[model samples]
Structure formats: C-alpha cells, structure tokens
Target: MKKIIITLSIALSFALPSYAFADQAACEAKAVSKDGKPLYGAAKDASIKKCMGDAKPNDCEAKAVSKDGKPLYGAAKTASIKKCEGGK
Candidate 1:
C-alpha cells in the first residue's frame, strides 16, 4: 500500500507539470493578432500571460456589458476582456 501510494504520488507530480506545460504551449501558439499575424513584444507577452491563467478569472467576463446594460457579444466582449486583463 505504501509503495502504491508513493508510485501514484510520483506519477501525479510528473503529470501535473506536463499538463501545465501543454496548456502554456497551446497559449503561446494562439498568441496572434486578429489579422492572423503573430503578436510581438507586449502583445505577445500579454496574450501568453492571460492564456496561462494570469487573468482575473470571470471579473472581466462579468464586466463585458454595454453602457445600456446589455451584455456585450463577439468582438466587443473579447476586446473588453482583453483590456480588463491588461492587454493592449
């Protein structure tokens, strides 16, 4: 039982970091502009940062609303969330 527990713990330790790295790579691959161009400098940094789960979770999503209190949709919501996440 002790050997099984130790083996399982070791497996989980390796699995967790690889999973995080895979997510990070996916985020980096997605760091591009709307025009299909790759982002550079601060933009790329911000994209990766947000994608790697550095953003304020649902705070920005909840704030995505129009002045008239209507929920923002599509590009507007995306832009709003990006801005709230400290991106350009």
Candidate 2:
C-alpha cells in the first residue's frame, strides 16, 4: 500500500507539471498567433485546441476582393469557427 501510494504520487508529480506546462504553452502559442486577433483552446486537450485554432478555420477570405479560400487556406473566420475543435 505504501509502495503503491508512493508510486502514484511520483507519477502524478511528473505528469501534473508536464500537463500544466503543455497547456500553458498551447495557450501561449495561440495568443502569439492571434496577434491581436482572438482564439480559444480545447478545455480538454491543449494540443487539439491549438491545432484547430491555429488552422484559423473559417470564413476567412483568400482574396477578399476575388478569391475563394478553403479551410486549409487558414485563418479562422465566422465560417471557420466550426473548426475550433471545442469551439472555445
């Protein structure tokens, strides 16, 4: 029992910090990319949230004046909001 408890504690000690750091980093990256723009992250997964948000998923114009931008074209807009993963 003591050994189990110790092992669990040790595992949590390492896992918790890494998890926290990853989330923070994801948020930081999103903020940097936003660059005055706005975005949200997945409440559950920092990476998933970051990926979709970074993709800039919707309504973004390719040319604004005369071009059709696709999803992968990047830059989230109204239509792209759906691509936000969790829609944060």
Candidate 3:
C-alpha cells in the first residue's frame, strides 16, 4: 500500500504541470477577437478576463443568482444583469 501511494503521488505530480500548460493554451485560444486576430498586452488580458467571466452564463437573467444558490432580488438582480450585459 505504501509503495502504491508513493507511485501514484509521483505520477500525479508530473501530470499536474501538463494540465496547467493545457489550461493556459486553452485560455490563449479563447483570447482572440471575432475577426480571428489574437489579442495582446492589455487587450489580451481583458479578452481573457471577459471570456472566462462570461463562461458561466451568457444571459443576464441567468447570472442574477447569488454564489450561495439564492436568486438575487431588486437592485442586486438589476446590477447583475447590467454587468453581465456590459461585458458582452
């Protein structure tokens, strides 16, 4: 059991870095404009931020739910809709 645990731990350590690199590549792929040009510098950063942020739900009404699983109400719901729509 001890030897199996150590081998699995070593294998996971090597696998994790590759997963991180793949995620970075995926983020870069998503950081392009609608015209197919890749964004760079501040543009790339902003694009990535918007891309990742919008991954949750594209619709404003869908994003009005709180992190705790409760639906937002009143000003909170309105604010969420505005922010989600503006990001697009």
Candidate 4:
C-alpha cells in the first residue's frame, strides 16, 4: 500500500508541471497580432499574460456577478473581475 501511494505521488508531481507547461504553450500559440503576424516584445508578453488568465474555464469576467446573480457593471464589475483574477 505504501509503495502504491509513493508511486502515485511521484506520478502526480511529474504530471502537474507538464499540465502548467501545456497551458503556457497553448497561450503562446495564441499570441498573434491583428496583421496575422506573431506578436513580439512587450506585446507578446502582454498577450500571453491575458491569454493565460483566460485559459481557465470560469474566468474572472465570467465570475463578476452581483449578490443577486445579475452581472455586475462599471467600477463594481472591474473590481470584482480584478479580485477574482488574482487582483491583476
């Protein structure tokens, strides 16, 4: 039982880093420009950052709902989205 547990733990440790790398790779693939060219420099960095933030299924904007379940608007929505997305 102990051996099985140790093996599973090892496997999970290896798998988790690859999962994060996959997200990064996918985000990088999307870092293109409006002219159909790949972005470079600060633009590429910013694009990848935004893309990674949106890779999650329930992203910050989607979670910016009011207490009554209605979608938030204006400054309220901005704050909610920022908080939900790790205050970025």
Highest lDDT model number? 1
lDDT of 2 by residue, 1-88 (tens): 9999999999999999898778777765655333554445543355455554544423333322223544332343433444343454
Among all windows of 10 consecutive residues in model 2, the one with the lowest summed lDDT is 57-66
Q: lDDT winner between 2 and 4, please give it.
A: 4
Tens digits of per-residue lDDT, candidate 1, 2-76, equal 999999999999999999999988998999999999999999989998788775749889999999999999999
Cα lDDT computed for each candidate against the true fold: 0.91, 0.53, 0.81, 0.85
Task: Find the candidate with the highest TM-score and give its number.
Answer: 4
lDDT for each residue of candidate 3 in 1-88, tens digit (9 for 90 to 100): 9999999999999999998678777887988878999988999988766655554454778778999989999999878887777754
TM-score of 4: 0.62
* Candidate 4, residue 87: lDDT: 64
Candidate 3 regions exceeding 4 Å error are 50-88
**For candidate 4, lDDT tens digit of each residue in 1-88?**
9999999999999999999899999988999988889989999999988877754536777888889999999999888877876665
Better of 3 and 4 by lDDT: 4
* C-alpha lDDT (0 to 100) for residue 28 of candidate 4: 88
RMSD to the native, candidate 2? 13.3
